[model samples]
Target: MADDLGDEWWESQPAAAGSPGVLAANANSSDALCGPSKTWIWTELNQRASSLQKPSGDEEGRDTEMMQQDTAPVPEPSQETKQPMECFLTQAKETKEETRKTKKWKKKKISEILAKSEPKPGTPGDLQQLIKDHYSGSRSVIELEELNLPDSCFLKANDLTHSLSSYLKEICPKWVKLRKTHSEKKSVLMLIMCSSAVRALELIRSLTAFKGDAKVMKLFAKHIKVREQVKFLENRVIHLGVGTPGRIKELVKQDGLNLNPLKFLVFDWNWRDQKLRRMMDIPEIRKEVFELLDMGVFSLCKSESLKLGLF
Candidate 1:
């Protein structure tokens, strides 16, 4: 059966044209904790391909004729024909000018988006203010619930002074000593939470410099099952775990994840998805994240053992 399906069989089958394939793919990509996540690159590629597409023969033929008329003198025509030809030339020139302006505007918009994508360092105070602003317009009574916690719960900002590996060393100076002394097989010393499995995977790759000999596991719900994660946690001495909020919440609820051993809880806080929305901006994900914090991390905050980092 595996041989028959061949490679790439498990990937999502793209829907037919005129279908909601792009929208559907984007929706799943955002909540990829439970499924494979695809990037918005496909949509970008499609848009590029469309822009590069050659105009139809009708339009091309008109352009060619217009060029020839402009370059070569034509025999004098009747008054009626001359007026329409002049109008046609004027319309064509206007269309060309409009197209040029459209392209220029698009380029400017793309640059603006790229600039906005850059990660800016923020203090714990900034994070608190952002939370307050996000919920300031509480239209309903239920939305009035306080999501922001005390300032002591948050660690200092990354400050862009060091690479992720070096930052980890600076923050957790005794990591080497703790790693050796830790004996729990079912708990992680550090847990990094992100918005999606795709980001989690990226974080795992970045951990190469920091992980060293310590075991790092991806705890998202993409291809792995809850039971499988439970077994891995029970059998292996995991030092780090990277996952999304929903799956992490589920694991903790099932007693598969132990927060007692967690010393550092990092949020992939500054990163934004293609839609320019942060993890907390997404309604479902925001709820799960707050819920996860309420589960056990809030209690751990009282002790000096657990420190929260906004990465």
Candidate 2:
């Protein structure tokens, strides 16, 4: 019985070869044997991946563009945005105008001060007032009393309305006669005391209009030596002498200047310098002027020989 079964099984195996199972197995083996190459498979995979990535990258770019649009800046709503710039401009203009006004005010103030400082024309009482005002603190009561001068002590100043030349002409009407008779050397017929050498020179120049070819000596201490001045005086007859009080006092002390022939003792009293200071305003000059007066000028005035003139 076993031999017969073995023959039957062998026969069944041959029939199964043509069945669906055997055919499906042969198809799978064939597919495995004829599969695509490695490079073709890689190329296919890469192409699919690139196609999918391209859509995703495009979508991402569109999303970023939409976000940028949403966050974009907008224009201002009104002209009110320019208010700060306009305000700054307005403030600058106001500051400029204020500065201009300040400068103008300063100029006006300076003009007023200068006008106040300028000296006015003097009167007969001007001399007395000035002497009192200037010497009240310095001189004693006795000295102040001594320093007093009557109306006769001062020359006729009503005609002295203008320049030094005009004043000289008004006061010294007989200057020519006096100059002719003034033959003494180292002596001057008229002595004009000033504050500085420059003033002395100025007075001398002003005298050209009044004094016609008559000898006028400069008696200031600037440049010229005392001995030279004394020698000049001794050699020439000077009709008019214009000098500072200090130098005049010095010369008088040295006997280089003679006051015997002096008729007009004129003081440049009313004149003011750039500082608005008069001759008596300066302490040293005032002292010298007083000393010069004390050195026989006051005595001569008391005797009515030498008249005091304030020009």
Candidate 3:
């Protein structure tokens, strides 16, 4: 019964109905037992309160510093480093275009040069030189002798000798007259004309009724005579008709007028047998001779029949 009364008295004490002094007395009692509990409480409370509340000024300062670091400007590439690449690309394009233009210009220049350099044919100077160089040669004079008869003489005998002789007399009068004029002064011209006349005589000898009238022969001989003192110009005579070979042979036989002596005399000094044969063998020589003969510029006959054979 006493213990119960004591317990009741402790529970019902006035301290329990706390006052400021009473709370202070309890804090003092706890502090005395724990020894500086305020510091530990303050630390723990600060940490927990900070986690729960909005950030303080110190924390905000740290965050702002980190954001400033992130936003800071990085160094840009230098102008010098970038310029070369742009310059190189620009130069490459320019160089390629320039090369293309250069090639086009070169081609144009080459074409222009070729056009300007092309040769003109049939110039007057060229024709004159051709005549002087080729027609003035002894070979040309010899080639003139190959047109003794027309190729189709039998069918057109009248036309053949008549047309041929007339053409020869007209075209070659200069050479023929030169032969007569310069027989002593120019042996070469004399020989060439004499040879030509001999070939002409051979053609005349082969004609039918063309007995080569004495008067006509005399005029022909006078025109060709090499003497300087004789004035031997006569009216032009024309031998127009054709005669048979039998009649021609009879006239030649009756008169015993051998033309071989004149032929041999003309050909003897100018031509050697081997050289003549070689010249005759050349296809170009033969063709040129035949063409000249066809044009009635000359005449050719068998040198053998004219007693020009080396044997």
Best by TM-score: 2
TM-score (all chains, Cα) for each model: 0.57, 0.59, 0.23
lDDT of 1 by residue, 1-311 (tens): 66777767646465543345654655566665343224455556466556556577889999999999899976796666457788899999999999999888874443476587965675677656655665567535454344546667777668766666777777778887888888898899998889999999888888787777888899899989999999989888888889999999999999988898899998777677887677866888887876787687767876656888977
lDDT over C-alpha atoms for residue 34 of model 2: 46
Give lDDT tens digits, candidate 3, residues 1-311: 65867676754465531345544555565555554676664455456545656687899999999999999999898776567788899999999999999888874433465467852222223322433444455456554333232322211112222343443343334433333343221111111111233444644554323222311232123244323212221222222212222222222333322222222111111221322322223444334433432331222233332211110
Output the lDDT of residue 302, model 2.
Answer: 69
In candidate 3, list every pair of residues with a backbone clash. Answer: 145-299, 145-300, 208-243, 208-244, 209-243, 209-244
Error of 1 at 278 (Å): 2.4
lDDT of candidates 1 onward, in order? 0.77, 0.79, 0.35
Model 2, span 109-133: residue lDDT tens: 4347658785455566876776677
Task: Return the clash pairs for model 2, or none.
Answer: none
Relative to the true structure, candidate 1 has a C-alpha RMSD (angstroms) of 47.2
| Order by TM-score, highest first | 2, 1, 3
The per-candidate count of clashes, in order, stands at: 0, 0, 6
Error of 3 at 288 (Å): 31
Least lDDT summed over 10 consecutive residues: which range in candidate 1?
Answer: 33-42
TM-score of 3: 0.23
